[model samples]
Target: MYFIGELKGSSPDLKISLYKWNSKFFVKFETPDLEQVYKISEMDVSEDEIREMVNEEFIEKIITRFKEMYQDLGELMGDY
Candidate 1:
């Protein structure tokens, strides 16, 4: 149930990590400097008591977004 959020701000130097446990999804956002961390409360979801509620599309989208964010950060750091 992990899902990545849309990118915000300029420079594309932000990083986001997402993971699913049981039926809940958690997300954490960090800056390129790794000195700042923010939790996105808007995209939280719970899978309580739902065993088969997981969807493939949802997981795919999350991984895609994470990759894009990572690439954007790499570009900003001249590692692309």
Candidate 2:
């Protein structure tokens, strides 16, 4: 089975999609021009629990990674 939903209260510039299938959860974070996906197990945890905890945690991580990536890109361009 498959299920999908949007993360409520997320930033307009950062849209988050949540999906569940095959006893696993898949989360996608997207902006106008960029996207990232994260997969995690559903083992032992209820879907509600995942929604409450994992979703926000993953989004925070994705945002942090994007920030770091952009910072590094700027530094690399500065070397030129």
Candidate 3:
């Protein structure tokens, strides 16, 4: 995987990174213990376009999903 760069302006608790691998671009968002990766075809979207695509609104949705995922994990762990 090739590291492109880190995205800015989202929640500080979340770390966002861009990468290229296997002819696909990987958009990775991470918290302390959890992460989410989104894949995009290089043929479909250029690198510059990716910056535009992963805007505030997109980050907001990811943040929301992360919250839901964390909640689900907590429930499954059962008082741990």
Clash counts for all predictions: 1, 0, 0
Go through the candidates in order and give each one's C-alpha lDDT: 0.45, 0.75, 0.92
Off by more than 4 A, model 3: none
What's the TM-score of each model vs. the native? Answer: 0.36, 0.65, 0.92
lDDT of 1 by residue, 30-80 (tens): 454442323333335333321223234544554566678767788988953
Off by over 4 Å in 2: 1-3, 54-58, 72-80
- Model 3: how far residue 40 lies from native, Å: 0.5
Candidate with the greatest lDDT versus the true structure: 3
- By summed lDDT, the worst window of 10 consecutive residues in model 3 runs over 7-16
Candidate 3 has what TM-score? 0.92
Better lDDT candidate (1, 2)? 2
lDDT of 2 by residue, 1-80 (tens): 36578876468888877888887888777876667777788886666875676556667788898788778878988999
Higher-TM-score candidate of 1 and 3: 3
